[model samples]
Structures are given as structure tokens and as C-alpha cells.
Target: MLRRLAPVVLSLLVMVLGVTALAARPQRSAPPHTADFVVVAGVAGLRWEDVDPRTTPTLWRMAERGSIGSLSVRSAHRPTCPVDGWLTLGAGSFAAWNGNRPAGGCPQQAVTVERPDGTGAKLPDQESVVHYNQEQLPWGAVPGSLAESVRCSVAVGPGAAVAAARPFGRVDRYAPALPEDPTQLLGSCVLSIVDLGTVAGTTRAQREAAARTADAQLARVLAARPPHSLVLVAGISDTDRSARLHVAVADGPGWERGWLTSPTTGRDGYLQLVDLAPTALAALGRPMPERLFVGRPAVAVDGRPDLADAIAKPLDAEREAANQRAVAGWFYTLLAAVLMLLAVAVLPLLRRARRHAGPHGPEPVPRRVVAVVELLLIAAALAVPAALLADAVPWWRAERPGLTFAGVTALLVAAGTAAVRFAPGYGSTLGPLGAVAALTALVVGADVVTGARLQLNGVVGYSAQAGGRYAGLGTVGLGVFLAAALLSAGWLAQQVRKGWRPAVMVAVTGLAVVIVGSPYLGADPIGAIALTAGLSVAAVISAGGWLTVSRLAWAVMAALGVTIGLAVLDLRRPVGERGSLGRFLAAFGDGTGGLTLHRFSTSNFDTLVSSPLTVLALAGALLVWFALLQPWGGLMRLFGIYPAMRAAMAGTAVAAVIGGVLGGVALDVAGAAAALVVPMAALAALRVLDHSTDRTVPTSGRPRGVGSGVAGEDGSGSDGGGTGGVGPLGDGGPGGAGGATGGRDAGRVQPGTATSDGPVG
Candidate 1:
């Protein structure tokens, strides 16, 4: 009775626990000191080495007395741009301009503009166009702008003002005259933005002159500020080269005299641009809402002079070198895919040759040789994780990437060989495959839990230098790893003892969902959606008898339901803490959701048009199709010959492809999906090859008059030994399909026992 009730009780317990965990609010750290006002000087594309103490004494002094670091300006949708950077800093979220202009055209000079109520106001000549664009363009808002939380805010330049005015609900536009003493304005405005257009100067001499002027202006403001004022000087972007890394410095209240470190990038001298607003709010003693901001606070770290030097290099050189390496990596990946396809095409001929060679054949490759081959495959399977670990090795730091990659591959292969030789279940068909899948899941999951340190450097994982993602698994890694682990683990559970098998399957599924879906762990909205939907369909198919159109529909509906439920929970969090689902919903509410969709669509279209990634994706899809229909009759037939397991594999493949396509389209990188689907497809093909050579049955069709080795759901005659004849199930016995039991075994086959004659139709 207790056993029967266990599933129900466990299900309820898990659901309750999940809800409670999600509902808990995040805690904010107390600021080291309080500040009355915060000033942000926006210097577009300002580099540390460009500023000399003699020419820009103010900036140099601030760096020595405050905190400084490299500011990563990459955004979710595009490379860093000045307009986007200022907007993101002010809004505390990722944002972009629609590049629309007002119908009447922009103002060329200073002019008096009237509010909708007819009140006249003077606007800066350069800022008039920006003001017009702000009112005309459709904008996406996840949270109220930073200005909304402060008592009063001032924007000194057009770029700064455009972002500052976003949260204002009134129809008035005004530009207050700059005070003679810049510090005098601090008493009235709690926040201020001063844009110096530092990168606008074309020549070194011109740039130096502009820097001196900006420095003097900054000195005046600092001299006038109150005792508790906080100042943040940042280079929002390099207009000429958007991808160049820039600088950020923090001074005054609560900040220590050292370099900056952040959890987002897991680098001591690096902080993302999105972190600025949150750090300012924390310094000013404001409460931060959950999930609304993608960045964490930048903490002060003990000064590391070498770290600063490493980050202070010319942005152009660093970007050029990184781009070169990335291109080479992509080319190598494409070559590998082509080779995998070639191997698949040749597998059939090899299998046929083995079959024609009689009972002994060419005595199987020595165990040692086979083990070496298996280890190599295992290393390939773990390519992403291995690359991540390789980044920290001292030899990897020597800039000989090729040598480091080879060494890491060899090490992983050796480790895998040792495990296969000693690990339990290694002799079983699913053992080694399951072990690889499980290890991949564990490594990736553990990295995510611990701030995604290794993945931050992994070739296939998030790239900190590129700033595409700072944490969490990439779409491709998540989809591929999750699918492989689930299928392998589920199959392995079935091969073990009966009493704990069902529980094992349940546990595996549950753990997978928790790891991938939990916001604090994976923090990936799209991933959570895809995994929830795909896993649900796979689980159902694994438990049910077969896949049909109606069953498929139900499975899809169940998946959709789970996805929506998770999205709704994300929406319940504060606007600042909301994930993609919540952000999209918020944008949709204000009719700006179309822009977000357009960004995703354009990104996907660009990737497809520009790269060979699509070819890899198509190859993967074709491989899965071939495995299911022609070569293996599906992976299900090869494993335990259980119809339910076959249904599960088929369903999972469909789900993975669907998820991969959706992820590729949504994330705008087809390579991510290709990376995921290609590996699993190759594994499936390999599984088919392994089964074909080992099984005794004819390749083309079902057996003629023999019993299957597996038992029915009822488990009757499960332990029966061999019967008669030469059959695939076992050594043959008597009475054809029913074995020695005659007609009594018509609907059921004894487990691990087979008749000598062909199976009965």
C-alpha cells in the first residue's frame, strides 16, 4: 500500500517544494556607505591608457582613489552602440532604438518648443533631434527608468537626456541652464548625466584637448558636490568601432580604492554595462526588484596591478585577435561535421562485411584497441566541457591554443578509458553512453550552479570577451546535453533491477527539470521552456505504448502548459528581476514586443545567411531521420526491443529537433542548435551500428517464428531460459513463437530467452 501511494506523495511534495523556492525573494547587500547624489560622466570610448596624468589629472586622481575596471558593453541584441549603451545604463535593462525620426523633421539649432499644453521651453541645439526621436519611437520597458527612482535627475547632453527622460509621463520638455558652479545643482538633483563626447575628436592632439576640457568641467562638478556624493565615470562606446572594450570608474561613498570584480563575468577587472544602474541604486540605499536586471553589483576587490594592465590593451588589437581565433574554430567545427557524415555513410558497408564473414569473423579488435577508440569518442562527446577546463591550464595561457586543445583532449580520453574499465555496467550496451551523457550533465550543471565559471571560457559555452552571455548554458549546449542525458538515463534505469527502476526514471526527470528550469541555477528562460516541453513529451512516450498523431498532440499541449506555467511565475517577480518571458510580456503590454521579435528574427536570419551552421543542422536532422526509418528502425529497436522505449526515443528526437529549431530562431544563432543536435544524432547513428553487428537477426525485417527475449508488463515467465533453434533472442527450443509453453505464451515472451526458429508472424 505504501509503495502504491509513494508516487502520489512524492509528486505533491516536489510541486510544493518548487513553488516555495520560486516564491522566495532575493536579498540585497547593504552598501558600505550612503550617498546623497550620484553623478555619471558618459565619455564615449574612453580607454585607460589614453588618459595621461599630466593632461587629465582629474581622471587619474579618481582612478587612484576609487575603483576602476574594464566595462564590457556588449548587449543582448547587438554590439555595443552609444545610443544603446546610454539607454541600457539609464533603463537598467537591455534596450535599443528603433531609428525612427519625427514626421516634421529634426531641429538644426536651439529653439523654443511648446509642451502639448502650450508651455514654451528652450532645448539644446544638439539635443533637439534626440528629444524628438524619444517621443516618436516605440520603446521597450522592463522596469521604470533609473531617473524614476531618484528625487530629481539632470541630463547635460542630448544623449544623456534622451535616456533620462524615458520614464517621465508628462508632456513637458525643458533644458535647465548649467549652474556657474556645477556642484550647486547637486542639492536639487539626486542624479546627473554629463556626456563629454570624448571619442568625437579625430586626431590625438584634438582628443587630448577635448579630454583636458572635459576633465576641467568634471573637476568643477566634483568640487561643488556634497560630502556624500558618488561619482561614476564610464566610456559608453567607441562610435567608430562599436566592439572596442571601454573603461568604468567609481568613486566616493561605499566604494574602496581598488579594482572592481563582479559575479556576472567572474573576472576581477571586468563589469558589464548593465551593472551600472544597479550599483548606483545600491549605493544610494534603494531596494532592487528581482529578475528585472540581468547584471549583479560590481564589488571592490584588492588591487591587482597586473589585472589592470591585461585589460588596458588597445581594443582594436584584442578584438582582431579574438575574431581570428573564432573564425578558425568555426572552420574546424564545420570540417568535423563533414567527417562525421562520411563515417555514417560508410557504416553499412562495414556491418555487411562483418556479417558475410561467418561465426568467428575477424576476431573483434583487441579489447585494448576498442577501449582506446571508445575513449576517443568519449573525449569528443565532452569537447565543450574540456575546452572550458583547458582555459585555466598554465599551458593554455601560453597562447598555443592548438597544443592546449590537444593536451586537454588526451587527458580527458585517458580519464574516460579508466572509468570504462572499472565502472559498473560498462559491459552493458547503454553503460558507457549513459556515463558520458550523465557526466556532461553533471559538469555543465555544476558550473552553472557555481556562477558558470568554466562555461564563461568554453569555446562552445558563453564567451566573456564577446559578452554574448555572462552566465548560464548556451542554447545549443543546454538542448543537446539535456536530451542525451534524459534518454540515456531513462534507458539505463530500465536495464537495472525492477523494484527501483520506476523511481530512478522519475528522479532523473525531476532533477533535470529543476536544474534547467530553476532561475537561480540556469537562469535561461528559453532553455527552461524547451526542456520542460521536450522532457514532458519524452516522459509520456516512455511510459505509454506507442506514438500516434493524437498522442503527439496531447504531448505538445502538455509541454505548452508547462512552458506557460513557468513563464507566469517569472512574471510574478519584480520588473528588474524578470527573465525573458517576463520582459517580453512587459514589452507586449506596451506594444513594443514587435521590436523584440524583429531583433530575434533578424539575428536568426543573419546567422543563416552568413555561416555554414545551417548545413550542420540539416545534416543532424537527416541523420536522425535515417536512423529512425531505414538503418535502425529507430534506436528503440536496438536497445531492449521494447516498443515503449522506441516510442520514447522517437518522441524525444522530434522534441529535440523542434526545440533546436525554435532555439535557433529565437536566440539568433543557428550554430547553437547545430552544436546540440549534431552530437545526439551522431550518437544515435553509432548506437544503430553497434546493435546491427551484435544482433543475430536479419537486418531488413522482423524475425519469422521466434520469441522475443523481453517479457511483458506483467513480468510472467520473465526468468525463462533458452528454448530451441537459432534465433536472435537466444538459443532456440520447441513450439515456435510460444517457446516450450506452446499457446500459453502467445502474447508474452520470456525475458532473456528466445526460440531457435524465426518468430511467428
Candidate 2:
């Protein structure tokens, strides 16, 4: 008994140690933050491409001397406007005015300013903007929180005043424009913000002119004498009606010569606009008020030898992220369409096969036709992972990115499907499904353990522009992996002895969940919860016996235990260090859990209605319940014969439901998984029904893939005429599905593809 459990225990122990090492990794701590004075140069719509030595010399030099990163300006709303950007920066969290503004380039920066005294100004209407962000929006942003944290502050322009004003809309010191010698104004306070104005234009010439103007003002501001100061430059928001990565530079005492990053965005050299407030407050030695800030202080990492190259990574991401937003919608719609087409085409065939079966035997399905449909089903399942892997190539930079991406993805799906169709043990019914599921799991899992580079701008992955996740496995990716891994694990459990099946299922699924829940890997606590729930259900069912209320209770209890354990582990880390699960736990503990839930619920609702993935999820669900599980569907017999496969499908479905809601992206995660697996399930049902009444199934009377019948289960070949040419690829493995003429039994059955009239355990 001890030897039997040794592998599972050892494997689990290894994974735990790996997670511990990754989580305890050194947090980015800026060196003491000794600079007492902080200067924030707010440059709206500044891209790295716009920075030139001749036209924007000061900004160019600033990048060369400091830590540089691309800024993601996601505020309380989509397309963070200039005003929204300024307020978010001020509050150190997502905030939006939600005012009526032009749909295109932002309206000219405006604020109703009243000069209270010679050196002070007040924007009366600023109070309204603050009120709207706090009272109406999900993010409870206090606009002047940055100023209120310190004793005094200075604002140079209208935009600067938006950031520098205290909560009541009052600016301690304000100036309409930069003074020639601003030493006194800058030295009078610990913090100073200068708006370099919007750098934007439809034409190249106009942009260059605007760049020169902002550059001149920036140069003058830097010329002022202020000792022991930190200078920060951020292209704070999106403009021209598009969201793109903007420049972020910090030239200060401890922040020189490195990549700028923060814990909020696990990816190096990328930080959000909200990070600016914490950066300023940290430098000035001011405490960040709890619940008022959502960003962490920026830290510098020294790795990139060339600043231009480091900055280019985010710039490329900007392009790829945009391209994905454009192409992914079309891809999901295509996926849903294909799955629907499969249903339209397969349903009739399955019913026809079933209706023709008589007591003597079942009607013979042409092997050629069966093989083709099986091949098509496999191809369909590969689409989701193929799209994600397609991002490996820089197709986004092509002249026609949308077309190029489609071509690349189609080729990948074709190649992967061909490989799976012809692989060894092709005759096994679970062989093909298991192979594809394994591929899906490997692609998503390999990407995360290796830094999630593929997921950064992956078509099926999360978007930085969306601002929900900057790094770690995305909710969609999590769903895909969850379904694939559990299915593959189910296939594996069937390969072992019946008594050992549950142990194997738990080990495989649990390790995958740990990777998913780890702060350093999947970086999604909520996903872990979903995975845990799925794993518990799968392991329980694999132990044998049909699902009962008591069994369901046991699964739920196991999931709850895992959820609490993960949250506790994550909360041990510092604020912003915890992943999704930890953050939710912390919020709930502090009485803000309701707000977080509302925020997630709202996001989920939006995705539920707007995303095409919802159609795919519903399709998968419908197929599972209405078609496969029904008496007319014919797949119900397959489940009664082989409960392990049933366990896999059940677990994936349960996990998908939990993930769809907790993941905040609604059906996208679950939909991708369903799109991948449901087609495969439909294909299996067709295969089983095709041979249900056949008289040539060995007469062994042993249902294939049940109890001890799974190993060595021979699958019938697709081609009909030959005695036994290998499964789809050619020259079958012992029982490969192939050109079928006369095999030993004349009818090769997939893993449990044959029906069993005996009672299930």
C-alpha cells in the first residue's frame, strides 16, 4: 500500500517545493526611496515610437538615463481618456469621469479654474469629477489623495491641476504655464506635476510639431534647480480613439538604468498608470492609504543591455494586443460556427446509425466516411490551442495581419490533427481524444512555466489593453487547460487498474491545479478554486459509483478546503503580491468584498452578453445535456460502460461553470474548453453508435475500455476495404483504426466504443 501511494505523494511534494521557491522570490523593493522631491511629467499620448533625439531630445535623454517601460493606461473605463488618465494617476487607482466627450481624439483639456490667490488655483467643477468617480464608479478613487498624503504640492497646467488638487478640488499652488526660472515654485513643495500637453495629430508633420512643443516645455521644467529629486515621465493615457502602450521613464537615485516594473503587472518593463501615484508617494516617504490605491510602487530590474530593445518589447506587445482584439473576435465566432456545423452534420449521422441497428447487429458505417468525420472533429478541437500558439510568430506585423493569422492557425490545426490521427494506439477510442487533450494542456502549461510569453498577446489569452491581467495564465487559458488536463488525466486513469484509478486522477489533476494556483505560475487564485472543484469531482467519480448527493457534498467540501488553503497562502504575501484569489479574500476580510464581487459580476455580465464565446459555451452545454446524455443521443451507453471518461467530462463541466463566473471573463474560458472537447465527444458518440449493433465485436462480450478492457483495446480503421492497414495514418499499431478489411474480429472497438448490457457499478 505504501509503495502504491509513493508516486503520487512524491510527485505532489516536488510540485509544492517548486511553488514555494517561486513564490518566495525576491519582491521588487526600490532602494529606500531617499529622494524627498518627486517630479511627475504627465505626457498624454506619448508612444516610444514618437521619442526622437532631434525632436524630443529631453524625453529621449530621459529614457537613456532612467528605467524605461511601456505604460498600460487602463482606467475605470475603456479607452482611458486624458482626463480619466490624470485622475487615475492622482488617485493611484482606476477612476473615470464618465462625462460626455468626443468618441475620437480627446476634447481639448478643460477645467473650470478660479485663481484663489496669486500662487494658488481652484477648479470648482473638479469636485463633480471626483464625486462621479467615487459615487458612480466601481473604483472608489479619491482624486486628490496623492496631494493629501503629503504636506504641499504644485501644479503647472490645467491637466496638472487635475492631479495635484486635494479631495475638495483645491490646489495648494498652481501656475497656468511654466516660468523661466521655476526653482522657487518647484522647491516650495515636495511634489510637482507638469502637464506636457497632449502629443497627438492625424498627420506626421502635426505630430512632430506637437512633440517639439511638449519637448521644449519638458526641457525647461527639468532645468529648474531642485536637489535630491526624482523625475518621472509617463505617456499617461490613450488617444486618437485607440488604446496603445505608452512610454514610462523614471530617472531617480535608485531607479537608474533598469527595466521599470511593479508587482501588479508581473511582466517586467510594463506598469499601469495607477502605479505613478504610488511611485511619487513612496519617493516622498508618504504612506499609501489602504483601499485608496490599487497600484504598487515601481521597481527597477537590471537585465536588458539595451534600453531601446527592452522598450520595443512592449511596443510590439501594443501592436500584437491590438491585432488580437481585432482577430480573436472573428476566430471565436468561427469556432462557434464550426462547432455548430459539426452538430448540424453529425446529429443526423448518429441518429441514422442508431435507427438502423437491429437485434441481429448494427448497420455498417463506411470506414472511409467515419475516418473523415473523426479527422474533422479532431481538427476542430485543435483550433483553440492552435490560435494561442499562432502568436509565436509575429503575424501581427504583416501587411494583412488578420488574413496571415488565419492562415497560420489553420496550418497548425491541420498539422496537429494529422499527428493525432496517425499516432500510435490510434485504434483506441480515447487515444485520439486523449492525444488532443494532452496537446492542449502542454501548450498552455508550457507557456506559463516558461514566463507566459505566448500568453502575453495570445489570441486566446488575456489582453493587456483590457487591463484585467498583465501576466500569468489568463482565465480563458485556464479554462482550456483545465478541461484538457482533466480529460487527459481521465484517459490515463483508465489505463491503470480500477482500484488505482482515483489515485492517478487526483495526482495528475492536483499537480495541474497547483501550477494554476501558484502565485508565480498560473497566478490565478480563482482559477485554482475552479480547478480544485473540478479535480475533486473527477477524483471522486474515478473512485467508482455513480455521482450521489453525498459524493457531491464530499467534492464540494474538498474544493472548499483547497479554496481556503490557497487564499491563506496567497494572503501571506504583501499587498498586490497576492493573485486573484488572495486579493478577493483580502477585500472580503476588509468589508470591501461586496464591491469586488459587484465589480467582477459586472465585468462577467458584460462579457456574457457581448462575447461570441457565450454561444460556444451554450453549444457545448447543450450538446452535453441534450444530445450525449439523452436516450436518443446514444452516448449515454458509452458512459455506463466506461465511467472514467464520464468522470472526465463531468469534472471539466463543473470546473467550467465555476470558472465562467469566478474568472470575471464569463464564458470565454469555459467556451474555449467546450469548443475543444465537445466536438471530440460528439465524434466518440458517432463512432460508438456506428458499431453499437455490430455482430463482429470479437463476441468476447467484454465492453472495451471498461474495468480491465481498456489496455490493448483495438480501434477500427477509417478506410473500409483493406484487411488491416494501420489507423488513419497508415499501417496500424496493434489495433489502430485504419483501412479495414478483415481484422481478427473484423470490428475494432475504441476504448469502450462497444455497448455493455450489464449493470454499471
On TM-score, the candidate that comes out on top is 2
Which stretches in model 2 have alpha-carbon errors above 4 Å? 1-26, 102-105, 355-365, 694-761
| lDDT per residue as tens, model 1, 167-187 | 433212223434577655555
lDDT of 2: 0.76
**Top candidate, metric lDDT:** 2
Give the TM-score comparing model 2 with the true structure, all chains together: 0.90
What local lDDT does model 1 show for residue 217? 71
Residue 402, model 2, lDDT: 96
Give a tens-digit lDDT track for model 2, residues 318-351: 8899899989889888888988898877776676
Superposition-based RMSD of candidate 2 using all C-alpha atoms, in angstroms: 6.2
